[model samples]
Structures are given as C-alpha cells and as structure tokens.
Target chain A: MIPTIKNSKWLPLCDVPVLDPSSWRQVIVQNVREGDRIAALFGCTHNASVPVRLYALLARDGQGTLSVLCTDVEKDYPSLTPECPQAHWFEREIFEQWNIIPQGHQWLKPIRFHAPYASSTKTSPPIGEADFFQLLGNEIHEVAVGPVHAGVIEPGHFRFQCHGEDVYHLEISLGYQHRAIEHSLIGGPNKRTLPYMETLAGDTTVGHTTAYCQLVESLAGCTVSSPLLRLRAIALECERLANHIGDLGALAGDVGFLPTASFCGRIRGDFLNLTAELCGSRLGRGFIRPGGVAFELDTSAFHGICERLTSVSHDARSAIDLLWNTASVVARFENTGTLSQAAARDLGLVGLAARASGVKIDVRKDFPCGAYADEPFPVQWGEKGDVYSRAYLRWLEILQSIHFIIDKQERFVPNAVQTQIGNLQPSSLAVSLVEGWRGEICHVGLTDDQGKFAHYKIIDPSFHNWFGLAMAMRNQLISDFPLCNKSFNLSYCGHDL
Target chain B: MIKSLWTRLKQHHRTIAFPKQEPRLPEKFRGLPSIVQSRCPKHCSECVTSCPTDAITMKDKQPHWDLGRCLFCPECSRACPHGAVLFTDDYRMATRTRDNLVIGPKEYGLAQPLEDQRRKLFGKSFKLRVVSAGGCNGCEVETNVLETIVFDIGRFGIGVVASPRHADGLIITGPVTHNMKSALEKTYRAVPDPKVVIAVGACAISGGPYIDSPVANNGVGNLLSVDLYIPGCPPHPLTILDGLLRLLGRRYSTSRR
Candidate 1:
C-alpha cells in the first residue's frame, strides 16, 4: 500500500521527500507497473542555480488517492522511458523545458519548440522544424499536413509515413499555438491568472477553471458550500455536454451522416446557450472563481434552467439517436482506428479515450472531490477502443451528465455562492483534478513563503492522451484520418500549453 | 430513414431571423459597455486598476476604454462605484478603423462597410481563411459555429474556404504567437489582391489576456492592415455575424435592447 493524498488537497512542500535519481526511477517504474497511472510528471526550479526538482503524481484509481514522489536532478538523469513506456512524453517534455538530458530517451525532440528555461529565447529553433521518425523503404512515402489546416481549427503539423493507403506511422509536431501559459503563472495568481485558466483550453472554460479554482481554494484552506459546489459541477457538466454533443455531430459529419450532424450542430448551441443564460458567456467564462462560483442560480433562474435542460435533453436524444439507428454510420465507426485495451493502459491514457478502451479511470468516481464527493456518477466505459466505442461512450456520458445535472439541481439550496479567498498557506502544494469533458484535468499549485505561486502546472487531458491518438493511427487507413482524428478531438493549444 | 426525417422535423427552423428580426440574447450576456464619464468620482481609477489586460487607462484623469483590448469580463463593471461603466447587450461593437475602437463618452460609429471599391469586389461572395495562430479555440469555435444551422453564415455568401488561394481575405484569431507569426504572414500573402483582414476576439485585436507576454505579439493589427475588429474575449457568434454583415454593407436591424 502506498501513502497518498485526496484530490484537491494540499500538503507542506517539504513533506514531499526528495529521492536519488535511481530510486526515483525505480519507484515510478514499479508503481506504474502495478497499474497506477501518472497523473502529472514535471520539473520545477526556482532559479537556474537550483537543480530541477522532478515531481511525479501517480493516481491510484482503485484506492481513490494520488501518490506523490520527488527527485532532484542537476543536469542529467537516466531515462524512465525504457522501463515505463508511459513516461515517454513526460521525459521528452522535461528534456525540452529544463535541458536536463534524459540520457537514454530513445527519441529526444522539442515538444513545444520553445527555448530551454536556462537558455536564451533567441537560440530556440523554429516551430515544426524537428526530426521525425522515418521508415526507409521503396514504397514508404511521407505526407505532411498543417500548422495551417484547411478548416477553422488550431494549427499543428502532422507527418505520416504511408505505404499506399495504409498509415505506417504518424508523427505529430505541435507548438504552433503555445502562448507560454504555465510559464506566465509563476510568482503570482493575479487577475491575469483566472482569465489564463479560463482560456487555457477555450472549449473547456468551466472544466479547467474549476480545476484552477479548486486548487486555489484548497491552498487557501477554504470550503465551498454544497450548493455552490453543485453549481460549479453544473457549469462543468454543461461544458461537457456542449463539446461532447458537438464532437458527436462532427464525427457524424465525417461519416457523411447529415441528419445527426446538422441536428447536433444546432443542438450543441442550445447547451452552450444554457450555460450563457447562467454565466453571461456562451463558454461559461465568468461563472467560476476561487472561493466559489461567481454567480448563483435563484429559484426562478433555477426553474428556467431546468425547463431549458428538459427541452434540450429531448432534442439531443432525437438528434443523437439517429446515429445509432443508421447502419451506414454505425458500420463506418466500428473498429476504425482501434486501440487495444493493453495499449491504452500502457500509454496511461485518460478520459473518454481511456474509458473507450475499458480503462476505469474517472477522476469523479476514483478521486471524488467538490460536488462529485457528495454525489458520484457511475463510471461509464467501453470494451473495444474503436471509433464506435469512443462515439458510443460519449452518448452514454452525455446521458449520465444530463441526469446528474438535473439531480443535483433538484437538491440545490439557496445560499451565499461565493466567499473571499484569503492568502494561501505558505510553502504548500495542492493538486486538483477535474474530469473534464475530455478526461482528467490536473492542476498542481505550489505556494511560496509569501503565499504567492512558486509554480503552477496544468496537465490538460490532451497531454496524456495525444500519444494514444498517434498509436491508434498505426496500420490505419490514411483516408480515415479525419474520422479517427475527430473521435479523439484532442486540443492543440491545450497540448502546446 | 423515417427516424432521420422525424428527427429533422423535430429540430425545425433553428436559424435566427437576424437583421430582419433581432435574436433574443440572454439578459446576462455581456456585450458593449456604455461609459458614463460624468458619473465617475474625482481621481477614481477603479476600472483601470481592476482591468486585467489594462484595456482601461486613465487619460487626463478620466477612464478611457480600448474595445480592442477588452475581454468584457465583469471586473470593470463591478469595480465602478458610480455605475459609470455598464455593459449593455449591444453586440454590434465591431469597428472598421483601429482609432474607432478606443471609446470615450460619446457613441462611436459601428463598423463601416469597406471602401466602395473593396465592397464591390467582395459584396456578393466572400471567402476567408481563418488562421488560429495561438487562440484557445474560443474564437475559432464561435467562428465555426456561424456555419451551423442557427447562424448559417453561408446564407450571407460568407464562407471559410480550405485554402488561402481560394479566399478573398483572411479572418485571424489568437494573439499571434512568435511561432505562428511567419505562418500568418505567409497565409496573408497567399491571398490575391484587394483582400480584407478581419481580426476577431480580443486576442487577435490586442492580445486579450496574453498581452505583453514575451511569446505573443499584441495582435494582427501590428503585423497587417486589419479592416474590421470584433471585440470580446471570444466574440459571440452573433457579434461575429453582425460584424461580417455590417462590413459587406448588408442591411441589418440595429435595435438591440
């Protein structure tokens, strides 16, 4: 049994003992092998003179606790990628950010094409200019797309090694959208911080904002009333419903299923409008804050919201049910871009991507906190990690979220929705995880002696699940790329940040 | 097939009858702010200090707002002791010239149509290539939403094309990060002559929350000639649609209450 902390709770920074390099590798490798997942792994340093302190947060889903471990490294450390394959991306990121060589990292490259923390900004290489793994064969040809895609989408370069129509490999090179979000959070959680969090992943305004607010509230040792917690949960779920519904519509569009696509395209807005009705912004921008949410639902407002929810739920059912009944749409989605359960677990995938592959790792159910603590929704999943499974899983989660929102709203109590968040405890660390529409959203906040942020790390679900997407592309049809990509629907800015 | 038809019937006529009929926006929707300078107490700078992006600044001891830099968040309105800054549901805040975006006490003109020649070139049909340089997808999503049944921007002869060569202009979002600067310039150059540039959202207009960050430039205005500016953290689909219509000199109702 490993010692751990509950979600959205803080502990003294000194309590996280620093281990030697070898032991650090061994412990992480051992725990992950025993079925634990790395919620977050990053390096933090106050200044150039100090060695980077590497922190690993391993989530134990079955136990509902997250284990924390730390190790100090000056310049170089042995790679964990060889032993724990899931640590591959984390290692690459660490090397890119800190310039601390992961001595044996098989594929070392810039994750975001930014200058090392210790290096001058001018020396950084241009974005999307990097070494991509190549397969040497007479028939193996490469196809490269983007940084500027055709549609109204974020930019990222994708290199595909294809043999005829079959994709042999996909090398996704992002960072065209990095705006230095995490780096901007150091030393303070000022007025700019909340807006930064709100737009961290724009579609996930409520999800990411909730995680940040929860982390801040935890550090400040503030407790939100149950009704306020429920309100935050409602906003978070509304964000989920909109995106999930929109993604389904997009998936349908990719398969040429217009009935579901067109209807859902409009239906998704209804959900967003519901959120706007509550928060004043379509994306739930001004609704969530540190101590509690910024707004509250009165009895009339609450009833109006419920009435709209009922109507939208009915509309969503009719729109989405078309996809399941249509044979052509069902056939196109089945077994396309299939990722096996073993591959999913090994890759440490989170959210619907992992759940679609039968991985039982919902932060709400596993590490229940805030609104979820009082009432937990059952974790929904799929056995086959195919495009169909992912699509179906979203529908299931949509139903669950609607029911959860209505159930919580019924029990809502009228109370003061917000409290003043005082100074955070000095020299403390807090971890907050929210099950965003996509998956687990991890926010780690570390406070200095002056109760200001020493470091703030945000691990959007896209960070852990991008590799899972790349792996799913293996041996897949090059033409089905759009459908496959839409299923995962990873955020480019979230990953780049 | 029957199921599909029934579902489509159930989802009837989702589009808003905008221009002819006003869209019913939520009461809480934060749009254009009306600044009453006379109401402000002497030497007061509450709105200026509360603004995260410094969108509000004291000019001659009077608070001046630059719409290009505003996120439309509640900070300024909440901070004003005298109810001087009140955000009304006026979604038509787009402006043609950069100078028009800076608001004082008087009502400024809304976005003017492109010069007679440019409007003639793109009046009936307009195609744009949207570049999400460093946007969080908020603006991009709303821009994409215009194509949906509710907005159906296609009805207005406005479309986001797949390539810059097929476009009459470019619609750019995000603060334009250093990494994306060259790509944006290349996209801008790819479009043929007599092209217009529309900067949507605070990020594209003035870097929004990311202003003054080392990685991000102020916005598209600094790098290129912008013809229209739609202001918001992520401008509402209605705001964006209204801007595009006004830019084309299309007649639309302006009665926003």
Candidate 2:
C-alpha cells in the first residue's frame, strides 16, 4: 500500500521513511497507474554527506488522499514518464534543480531555463536558446512569434511548423520571466515571503498567497478562525470570478464578438472592485497573511459585497449569454483547437482546462479544506474539449462561483479574524493545495532543524496546463491559435516562477 | 442587433472625467505615502523593519520612502505607533524622473511635461508600445484596462500601438529578468529618437518583491533611461492615466483639493 498522508498534515521530514531507488520507482509507478496524479515531485538536501532526497506527493483524486513517498538519489533514477506521462515535467524539473538525471526520459529538456540551485559543475545554457523539435518537409514553413509580442502581454516564444494554414506542430518556449522566486524563497518566511507569494503570479495573488499561508500556518500549527476561513474562500472565489469574466471577455474578443468583449472587460473590474472593497488592493493583496486574513469583513462590508455581487452576476450572465446566442462566435469556438480527453489525462491537466476536456478533478471538492470542506460546490465539466468548451466552462464556473460566494456570505459566522502563529515545527513538511483561478496551486514547505524553510516548491496550475495548450494546437489552423491560447490563458510568470 | 444597440444605449458612459473631476477611489486604497518627520521617535526603526521591500530607509535623519520600491502594502503605516508613515489617496504619483519617486518630508513636484518641442510633436498623438519584461500580468492587465471602455486612454490620443516603431514612447512593466534583458534593450533601441520610457508598477520601478533575486536585474531603470516612474504594486488604472496625462502636459481640469 502507498503511504498516504492527509492534506496539511505536518510530519517530521526524517520520519518519511526513504526507500531504495528501485523500490521507490516501483511504488511511484504503481500508484500513478492506479489513477493517482503527481501533484508535486521535488528534491531537497539537508547535509553535504547525504544524497538529495526526492519527495513525490501522489494525489489520488477519487480517494481524496495524498500519498507522500520519498527516496534518496545520488545521480540518476529510472524515468516514470513511460508509464506515467504526467511525471514528465516534474522529472525534468527535478533534473534541472538537482542534476539527478531521469534515465530513459525521451525528451529531457530544461523546464525553466535557470541555473541549478546549488553550485554545479554543469554549465547553464541561456534561456530560450535550447534546441526545439523541428519538422522538415518540402512545403512546411516555420513561424516564430515572441518572447515579445504585439499585445500588452507577457513574454514567451512560440514556434509553429505550418503547412499553409494548418499548424502541424507547435512548441512553446518560456522562462523569459524567470525571477528565481523558488530559490529566493529558501530560508524565508520573512516579511518578503508573503509579498513574494502575493506577486508569484500577480493575477492569482489571493490564490497563491492563500496556498502559501496555508502551508505556513499548517507548519506553524496555527488554527485559523471560521470567519477568516469564510473570508478567504470568498476572496478566492472573487478572484476566480474576475479572472473567469476577463477570460470569457478575452475569448469573445478573440472571436471578434464586440458586445460581450467590451462589456465583460468593464464587468471584470466590478469583481475586482468588490475585492478592493474586501481589502485595499483590487487583486486581493494584503488581504491574506500567514496566520490568518489581515482584513475583516464587517456587516456593512458584507452587505456591500452582496449588493455588488448580485448586480455583477446579472451583468456577467447577460454579457456571456450573448456569446452562446451568436452564431459566428459559436462557429469559431466549437471544434477548434480540440484537446482529446485522453491527451488531457495523459498530460496531467488540472483545473478548468482539464475540466473542459471532461476530466472531473477539482482540488476544493476532492481534497476539501477549510471553507471548501464545509461549503461544498459541485464540480463542473464539459465534453467537447474545444475552445468553446473551455470558454463555456469558465462561464459556468463564474455563475457557480457567484452562487457559492452568496451562499457563504449568507451563512458566514462571526469569529476572530486572526490567531497568533507559533514557531514552525522543526524538520517538518507541509503540503497545501488551493484551487486558484487558473487551477490547482500546490505549495510544499519543508523546514530544516532550525525551523527555516529548506525547500519551498510552488507548482502553479499553469505549469501543468501550458503543455495542454500546446497539445491542443496540434493539427489546428494557425489562425485559431490565438483563440485557443486565450482560452487557456496560462500564466508565463507563474510557470517561470 | 436592436437589443445590442439598446443595451449599449442604456449603459452609462463608463469613462471617468478625471482632472476635470476626482476619480472615485476606495477608502482603503493606498497611493502616495507621506512621512511625518516629527512623529518618528529617534532610534525607532519600526517602519524600516516592517517594510518588506526595503522601500523605507533613513536619509538625512528623516524617513525616506521610495514609491518605486514600495508594494503599497501599508505595513509601514500600521507598524508606526506614532503615525510617522502614512499613505494618502493621492493617485497623482507619477513623475518625470526616478529621483522624484523618492518621497521624504519635503514636498516633491509631480511629473513635468516633456520639452516644448517634443510636447508639440507628440502630445496630441502620444502612441506607446508596452513591453512586459517579466511583469506578473497585474501591471499588464491594468495597462490593458487603459484601452477598455471605462478608462479609455485613447481619448487623449495616448494609445498603445502594436509595434515599437509605431510608438512615440514605451511603457515598461516588471522587474527586468536576465532572460528578458536583451529583448528589452532591443525593444528600447527599436523605438525612434526622442522617445520616452515610462516604468509602471513597483516591479518595473524597483523590482518590487523580487528585488534581490539573482535572475532579475531589478527594474527597467537599471538598463534604460526611464523618463517616468508610476508607482504602485500595480498602479491603479486611474493613477497610470493621471501620470501619463501629466507627463504629456495635458490636463482635463485643475487639481482637486
């Protein structure tokens, strides 16, 4: 049986019995084959004498259990990608960080083009300069887009091998926004740590910060108040509302649907304004700190939020309904840039994108925590896996999230906002998963003997879903690329971090 | 089509008449930070210690807060027992030079207009190309909002163009990372002569939270000559508009008290 641990359970790092490399491989492969998803796999080193310890947190969605298994490695280990395709990126990341090669991994490449954490003899290659998969043909032409683009968007390179209008294959090269966030996070739970989490992905500030705070609080053994927990869930859903609205608007804009496009843009701000009502910042920054929430929602503020939410929900529905009603928008959306459900599962896609492909896995529902445990919402999914499915899923989620917020608001109980966070449990590990706007945001914190963070691994949902976007573009028209991309709306900085 | 037209007609004109009127800001919305020299007790380093980004420092025996470096978290204000550090709802925090972003007890001037010749050349049609070096989409989205129906920055003829060649200036965001360094430099060089560089958000101004990371070069100021610095974690859209309009020497109305 795979050693399973409850979510947010902080246990001594040394107590996680380490197995030999081969048995470790057997256990991981077996668990993954048994319908488990690789939530996080990373390496941590405590002393110079011992080899780097590898921790694999296997998430069994159906069971609502996380299996934490680890092993020590000196140089190389057998790659699980052949059996478990989801292990591809995680293994590549492990190799990149610790130089522990995943033997027999077919396409071993730099996940984020950055220097290894520890001093290494291996030379670091410049980011975006790696060899790309090339397609050679008589009539095939290559199209290379930005690290810099025409729009007011983040930088990342895209290479498409095209035959006339149809794209044969597309490779996305990122890491232009690599800010060394994960490396900078080591030995820190300082004043800068919360700010770092808040900006890890600027748009998902509440999501990332909440996950970070959850990890920290769990490690520090702090029990958050019920009201604060409710407030956090509200803020997270608000973030989801804003981003979903913005994304739907962007999708509409991409399809040349002007009415919904312009309306959703302004309406997105309304949700952000509501968040600003909750805290000071529009993006819900400064609202969530380590111990608990930094702000309070009084009766007037709660009523104010309700008033705005009702109006905004009405407006958002009317605006989005136009997209479904319009023929032109539907024609462009449906059957365009479709990712097969099989491919989505293979790629280990999470959150909305995965759900759009009919893979029903939501962190909140599967592994319930805090407010999500008490105030449960049904998981929403779509079957088509096209751009339309993705867009429609977001629309459905926005409506559902609005209702969820209203329900939580009506049932909110008054309690203390914060509690004192004591010193962290030394040499312990804590894993936290928050269903961010994009998807599942996982943060793993491992403390040394001194109670300082030895390793803090932040896995943004974008990191998993970016590959799904690339796969969706296979055999798709080059013209539909932007629409498909906007549907995904993966975060470059989030992935880079 | 008729329903759409009717909906559009019924919708309120979303654009705020700023400069002519005061833009509505939330009560807790933080903007320009002000320091009270008299309020700070000697040897009390509470505000400095509370600051996450080291934006607050002691200079000339008075507390100096760098707007460019501040995340606008209000931790400094909350940490100060005597209320030495305070944030005002002043959205007009954009300035012409980087030095102007550093706030002390003495009053500092707002962003000045371009020279007479340059202002005449591009004031009515200031086209900008935004390059997000490593910005976490916060600043990028806010910048994008400027073009939306609500803020409608295009009303002043200050629009974001598709190409750097078409732009009269560049509005840069994010702490310029090493990977994006060359691209930023190339984009900067691609713009024509007499072109201005505006750094928006704390990251673009002073690297924000990732200030000391090995991969990041801090802010755009380190690589290029920045003409304007608009400060916020991600500055409010109105604040961004206020700064851009002020720099262009275009005012809708007199400043409100």
Candidate 3:
C-alpha cells in the first residue's frame, strides 16, 4: 500500500497545539470515548520528558486505516484503547516506556523490558516492566519456550497462553538480548556504532547498517553518489542472496534433507567469499560510508562476481528443484502457520511475512530508496501468507536479485567517488525504507537544532510483525513452529533494539 | 541415486585449501595488525592524519597502535611515502597481551615482519578457534566455508569453534556489544589460558564501523586483550587462512598479519 502523504504546512488533525521543540506547555486534554481513536498523522507531540516522538493515528472510520492523534493526554488525558482496539499495544508500549498514563487504560503489561529498567530511560521514564504486557486470565495456560533452541538461531523468548491446542491469548516477552543500543549511542555514536548495528542480528547486517548509515548521512546532510547507490544495492542484493540460500537449505533440512541443506550452506560460503573478494570484510561492513560507499568495484572484481553469479545461479536452481520435488520437504512446508491478510495488516506486518499474505508494500517498490529506485523489478507478493508461500517468495526474490546483479555487472562502468556531502538543514526530517531480506525496513531521524541527530528510531520489519507471528501460531500444531518461524525468519535482536 | 551422485559430482567444491595451497586474497585484504620492520618510521606524521578512526597515537615519539582500534585497511601504508606499511602474509596474529601491538614511531617493537612472528609462535603446529561475536556473519560464513570441500581450513588443522572451550586460540568478528559481554567473556574463559585471542575484521581489531555503540565501552579493547588485529569489515577468506598458518608457526609474520 502507498504511504498516506500529508503536507504539514496547514493545521494538523491533532487537537493539541503542536508544541515547539523547546517548549513543554500547551497540553490539550480530551477524553476518548469507547470507540473513539485519537490519530495524528502530520506532526506528533515530542515528549520532552522522554527521548521519543509520539504520533497518534485515531481510527475515526470503521475501516482499517487509523485516524490522526487527537489530543495531548498527560495529567488530563483520556484512554483511546476503549475506542480503538489496535491502539491497545501501541499505547501500552508508549505508557510503559515513557511513563505516560492513558487515564482509564485497561491493560498495561510489559512488552519488551524484562526488569522495567535495564538502565536509565532518558527517552521516557518507563511504567516499570511489570505493567506493560497483558495480564493472562486464570484459565490461560502460560507456555515458555526458549531463549535458546536446538537449531541454529539467535536468542529470544516466546510465551503462549492456550486453552488446549489453540491459543486463547498470547503475550511475547522479549529483551533477553537488549544491548541498550539507543542508550549506548548516547555516549559514543560514531563509526564504532556502525558495526554494532550489524550484530543487532546476524542475518540483517547489510539492512541494519544501511539504515543506520542512511540516517547518519542524512543527519550530516551527506548525499552519496549514484555509483555508491549502485554499490549499496549490489551489496544488499548479495546479502539477500546469502540469506535466501540459507533459508532454502534450512527449510529443506527441517524435513531431513541433509544433502540439499549441506549444498545450500556451502553455496552460502561461496557467497561470503564473493563478498570478501570485492570488499575487505565479509559481511559488507565498512563498505557503506556516510557520503557513499568506502570501496569501489573495479573491472577484475566485477568479472569475478559475474563468473561466480553465473555458476551459482545454475547450481541454486537445480538444488532448489531437488528439495522442492521431495515429498517430505513439500509436505512439511505446505499449509503451516497461515496468517490471513486481515490479521497481517492489523498487526502492521511488513516484509516477506506480510508479502506472503499478499501485501504489496516493499520499501524498494513502494518507496524506492538507493539504486533500487532506478532498478526495474516488481515487488514479490504471495497469494497466501503461510510457511509455504513465504519460503517460495524468498526464493523468487533471490532469483530476481541475481538477475539484478547480473544486469548491473554486465553494463557497469566505474565513476569518480564523491567525497563531500551536503550540509543537513535542521528543519527537515527524511524517512526512507529499504526492502531488506526480511521485509520493509524503515529509518526515521530527527535532526537537532544543530543538524545533528536529535533522535533516531530504526523501525525494522521484525518489530511490526512479532504480533503477527503469535497470531500465525494460533491453532497450528506446536511441532510446526520451527518451519513457521523460519518462513517468517524475524530477527530477534532487530526487534529487541 | 544416480542423479544425486551426478549433482554431487557436478557441483564444484566450495572451499579453497589456503595453507597447503595458495588461496587468492583481495589486493588490500586487511587481516591483522603487525609492524613493518622494512621501513621503520623516522617520526613522520603522515599516517596519523590518514587514520580515520584515530586509533593511532604517538607516545614518546613512537606510534602506539591499539589493535582494538586500528582498522587494517592498509590505508596507513598507502599514506606512507616510504611504503613502511607492508602487507605481510602473516595471518595468525593473536596474543594474550592487550598491549601486543606496538604504538609510537620508535617503539613499534617490530624486530621483524608479522611473518617472522607467526614463524616464531607456531614453529610448525597450531590449533585455532574462530569466534564470530556479532560478526556480520561474513567472516563466520567464509570461515565456515573453510571447512567445506573448497577452502578447507581443517586441512591445516584450523577450524571455527562455536564455543571457546575446545580452542587454543580465538578469532573474533564484529564490534563487541554489552549484551555479548558475558558471552565474549565466557568464550574467552572457555578457552584455556596461555591461549591467544586474534581480533579478526576491522570491527574486532577496532570496531570497524560500529565503534560508537552505546553498549560498546569500546569494541574489542573493552572485551579482551586482543593479540592480533586484522582489518577489513570482513577480512578476505585467504587472509584468514594465512593468519591461521602464521599462528601455527607454519608461515612468517610480515608487517600486516
């Protein structure tokens, strides 16, 4: 879906007089009715007390599209959850994080924080972790599954409330891996933080770092050259290829297909080799700088990439065909963890997870950023948002990306790298989204009065889809969680941040 | 069964046995930090400005390099008119001493190149463990591939270990994060003492790009005493293999390991 664009020149839909950045007064008080939503689309109220920016989207219409924020609910504020069912989680997150109370609010259970306060919350004083997530009913059976699993994966905890095999209620308790990234950046936020951004999750190094650099470069008013944009796209495509291969192998492995699994894994290594050959580091780290990419792609390396691409593509196709034709693999993946379109949108899911459910919202296609803006490719969408669909969609994307790289490599020519960047104006706020291998990755940055970053929030595709994951798990046999989870392949550290 | 065998036969082995044979590395593959004794610094300040991260500082007229901060892009060598910054084939660059890398012009402590040091350390045999603490999974990916049929590191008795418990040395990637503090420490503790910690990649050697993390008290420096410092966001696969051999004393420690 296209992003609803609204000009901020005129008055905002929000009721509260948008306070200037320096001031903290002018709080408009409004009481929310049982079905009333307070949505704000144009400009959000900056909670001076917290480091976060609050924008409300009240659902005045009965339709799925939410409304704008209506009031500045502080001491005299009212609860909008009674009016809008979707506002339940967003409000809880804000309340627990920034210590803002939605007067007459219903549920306040901790969502991300384990201890309410890992360190000090300069953004917004938290409402204590204890009162953020939903409180389970007495009839609810709480099931805690892991910070560690038997398969190779990052650490995260999943708690399910069920009435037999079907989920009666669900609450996900995250933060077992909160590294206090935002807090840490407060002290030292230069090149050092760039690589740390990569580890927020292993698979998303390219996506996370790209978003982080884009935010920083934008804050610095630095515009990378076109060649650099192409380079970034190529790097992103490479990272995407590696991930898709691993997933293909992993999904196949789940069904006792070891040869395909091993073959795919070995191909992943070759992918890494190709990356290391072009760039000094393996994971495409340091390749992206503030102004543009740090390294350049010359003829020999370009030829090398081309040679590898040709053979790798052929091998991947055959290997995948073998796995797909296998009865066991096909049976395991089909009809597992299905998430309908309605449920997907309600949870604000993006990326392959949502795409499999037929959501046509790719950051690359919807809001093209980087060289993707120039590349000609349609967003890959699935007819069903199930394990099988998501898996197939990833493979399709990988194929498309390979063609993209081959096209670039064939017609590519080197140009001079631009070293200087433009000075950022403090009055602007630029938001760009990248179609990371996971899904749509959004980056938003608030420049300071001095044009430096005042506040930066990187909303990875994983964050908006976690709830959708819980919903997808409903009614599915517990054994299928692995395949289902792999299909979604959400990054735990990506969300924890 | 015949088709399966055909597929296996048709697939080119993915690994490249670097030590027993020569595996091609990129031209400017920044693997680890080692001093180039060929052209000792005569107190020139050119490299000082060339360092983007300021990991280099002069102490008593000597260049004291914190491998934890030095991203071995070979940019320093590029900046040096004398070509004092050399890319030694020495890959096994690791040590228990946090101050292993020499800083300042005169006190560079490079009696020989990194190749010499590797020869000294390994003499012949070495056991290595590669740790990817927050690696982009690039280093880990290639390193894991090292075990495959193409670039087999095990041919030289070097492989990546998931935990530090069974390792004689440690190879790290990515910048050190606060959450990974316990894990890094546990892995280091898991490996027997008198063991070496090799900082791989620009991040591990010196938080390549993500050095400014809030959780990072300072990337590799705060985590452990990095012996060998390799640069590159993800150091080249062959460079990694060469570093392994250098540690086993199979090769010599040139200037840049």
Task: Please tell me which model should have the higher TM-score, number 1 or number 2.
Answer: 1
Candidate 2: interface RMSD equals 1.2
Query: What tens-digit string does per-residue lDDT give for candidate 1 at B1-257?
Result: 77778888888888888867878888889988877757977488888988989988887776778999999888888788888888888888888887788887556768878889989989999999999989799999999999998899889999999999999999999999999999999999999998999999999998999999889898989899999999998999989999999999995445563
Lowest lDDT 10-residue stretch of candidate 3 chain B: B105-114
Q: Where does candidate 3 stray beyond 4 Å?
A: A1-53, A56-93, A102-152, A160-171, A183-202, A212-225, B33-54, B71-91, B101-257
Model 3 / residue B194 / CA error / Å: 12
Q: Clashes in each model (backbone N, CA, C under 3 Å)?
A: 0, 0, 74
Please report, in order, the local distance difference test score of every candidate based on alpha carbons.
0.89, 0.86, 0.59
TM-score of each: 0.98, 0.98, 0.75
Model 2, A263-306: lDDT tens digits are 98999998998998888799988989777787767877787788
Best by DockQ: 1
Superposition TM-score, candidate 3 onto the true structure: 0.75
Q: How accurate locally is residue B155 in candidate 1, as Cα lDDT from 0 to 100?
A: 90
1 or 2, which is superior by DockQ?
1
Q: Residue B248 of candidate 1: its Cα lDDT? A: 97
